[model samples]
Target: MDLKGKTIAILATNGFEQSELEVPRDRLKQAGATVHVISPTAGEIKGWDKKDWGRPVTVDKTLDQVSSSDYDALVLPGGQINPDLLRLEPRALSFIKEVFNAKKVVAAVCHAPWLLIETGIAKGRKMTSYKSIKTDVINAGAAWEDSAVVVDQGIITSRNPGDLEAFSAKIIEEVKEGRHVQRNAA
Candidate 1:
């Protein structure tokens, strides 16, 4: 999918899965979209490697400085700490809600869907996330699936880092479509 001229916002804090954020960010940039990393703080956010923490990524903007209308899509990368921190930030949660309310595409991987649950936007949506989160997703009113990638409405979710290939592909597709496909009447 071609994303030329599109802007994607990644909302995260410390402990984001290194590859989850890096891989998709690089891929999105390669697809011709501008990627911005935003968080509640102004400096850099640390990433979590498989066994240990990884390097820090510079934050492009603070949650207070971002508006859902400023970007075409939103991405939330998961690491235990990343989404945990994000869920507690009122501004961050509010920003996420704005994205959903605007009907913009939202792509979340692994534990990141925790933030989606916190935003209360998963009601009646189908999605997938890290295995450990299946119960949480279901409790939030979402139908949890075990697929490599699941797309419901404009929301795209993946199981884990192993699912990045499918996750990345779905993000590109959703961004290219620029709007969610309405469910057909059963």
Candidate 2:
């Protein structure tokens, strides 16, 4: 029930879904893990609430300052803009790929699976995402489902903010179980 010595990284830039990022970060920390808000920028990143921009969350480190090996897990909080913007960054895709290859737990919510798609890790996993991007997920070869949370190997995904509790709980559970084996690796 505790993550006393774990370190988790929440990767995002501006336009993340507010609750999707905050809820898990706070919950993970309260469970005794050290969580860092890593972004493409150093300073603060603003989030997107339902209809407009939300408050800013401070960045603990920039993408260039950290490595995937230092983390036990990586989280990607989704908002339409956040994942779209991140998809355009080569470094972000590379970082995600590194994390996956290292077999660390990677949790994404809402539209965040867009990242897993970009990294090619979604090709054979069972996953879920905000309904709007269900096709994109399927196109990426993921076995998409409509569940609140879907985990295949080390990747954990949820539909939207409405699934936060389950999503966070699944992450905590998976992290505690430690890294996964790449069952279908080529």
Which runs of model 2 end up more than 4 angstroms from their true locations? 184-186
In the order shown, the candidates' Cα RMSDs to the true structure are: 2.6, 1.1
Task: Evaluate all candidate structures by whole-model CA lDDT and list the values in order.
Answer: 0.89, 0.93
- Candidate 2: tens digits of C-alpha lDDT, residues 1-186: 399999999999999999999999999998899999999889999999999999999999999999998999999999999999999999988888888888889999999999999888899889999999999999999999999999998799999999999899999999999978754541
**TM-score on alpha carbons, each prediction:** 0.95, 0.97
Native-to-model Cα distance after best TM-score fit, residue 120 in candidate 1, in Å: 1.0
User: Tens digit of lDDT per residue, candidate 1, span 38-76?
Assistant: 989999999999989899999999988889999989999
Model 1 misplacement above 4 A: 181-186
For model 2, what is the error of residue 128's alpha carbon versus the real structure, in angstroms, after optimal superposition?
0.6
Error of 1 at 65 (Å): 1.5
